[model samples]
Target: MQSIEKYPHYFNSIKEVHENIQSIIPEIAGAYKNKYNLSFPVDINLIVGGFGSNAYTYRQIIPNITFALEKLSPNPDHLRVIVAHEFGHLAQYIMLDDAGMDWSKSRWTHPLIWLYREGIATHLSRQIADNIHPSVYFSYNDEGVQWLTFAQANMIRIKQAFMEDFKALTSEKLFHEWFSINGGNRFGYSRLAYFLGNRFVLEYMEKHGEQATIIAWREENFEAKIAQWLSQEGVDKSE
Candidate 1:
């Protein structure tokens, strides 16, 4: 429920981001409460540096939500989407806790599970964005447009290559290769899992309703459902 901003020395002059985060926090909190029935009072820290475009959520010892402002797009709408996305992770943490699921145990090590996590968060974020401003759901200027476009264009080839190689790889190796920018076989894009995860979520939402999708996050059989859905949808095969 508390929003904190930690600016790097280089970002001392930035003042607008504070106002921006302040404006979006209530909206995100409201959406989480309405959609997931969870009151998220977690401390959200916006910092200056991180790895990817999305805000990072740490759930190990404590629930920490950190957003790397430098990594996010400067567009205000885009920033709102990022906040919703990270808050979706916060919602997941609460749901997982209530369900008695220990994410750090062994499930965190699985790449596909990570894909589902990211995908579900992406879906919820889009839902929140749509509720706030429908236009921003998939804005042309959004970075996700480029990633989704590239993924769709190359899905056939990417899926083909993935199935061929996936059988021979370990979970850790597969996770890194699919997610790393320097892996050198990403079909000219990194974070292939994000795109795949998004598609998986879309398929699930289309078949089931949004409520079902939201409830699946806390289900013990969520991973099994993901595997079954992938097989049923033939994710590894050409359409």
Candidate 2:
């Protein structure tokens, strides 16, 4: 574990946020494990930016660790939800490589990674709340909703592409270029992927059973995986 100095004397509120986050970790992890059958005491990947900024990350590294995390919240209830959303990231990251596309430096690399990453993380942040809890959001930005909607529309298409009808994107340069060109829309791409990916996963489980979905999530043919998604949805490729 590494320790970074706190943002010295910024908004001072950052410390409170930090303390709040640490306090809630254990309870959050417990809920995730119980609900999802995930491993407990999960690793946390937290990045707190100077006033008015935050980012979350998780790795697809092996040995399967899903740190069920809720995000930063001053309120106790919101904090727990944030932690769970982060846990969602951990779950997605563990399954990333199995989807078979390498991570691209491009902002656009998100789609290649797997449908779970972008949408779920944001979904956790924005949606995924108990009836009593406050919703998470991207700085109360309406554009955020638009981006999410965009992703939701295209998700089915992207997942199908992941399963099939896809080219192995090996060019790092191309990846970076496309990502840079797309910029924030890359986020939208991720959202779209998640929207579709989770549905596919849900249906897959219903049809194949939990164990099969977990195993096939790791080994199914990329094209075959996509066929089901693409058949049902037409992506709004505008942008």
Off by over 4 Å in 2: 1-13, 45-78, 89-113, 116-182, 185-191, 209-211, 234-239
**Relative to the unseen true structure, what is the C-alpha lDDT of residue 179 in candidate 1, on a scale of 0 to 100?**
57
lDDT of 1 by residue, 144-209 (tens): 556556666676566555544456788767766775544536466666766666677777778887
TM-score of 1: 0.73
Write candidate 2's Cα lDDT for 30-74 as tens digits: 655565555533456445543322334433343232221221445
* Lowest lDDT block of 10, candidate 1: 1-10
Model 2: residue 28 alpha-carbon error in angstroms: 1.5
**What is the overall TM-score of model 2 with all chains considered together?**
0.52
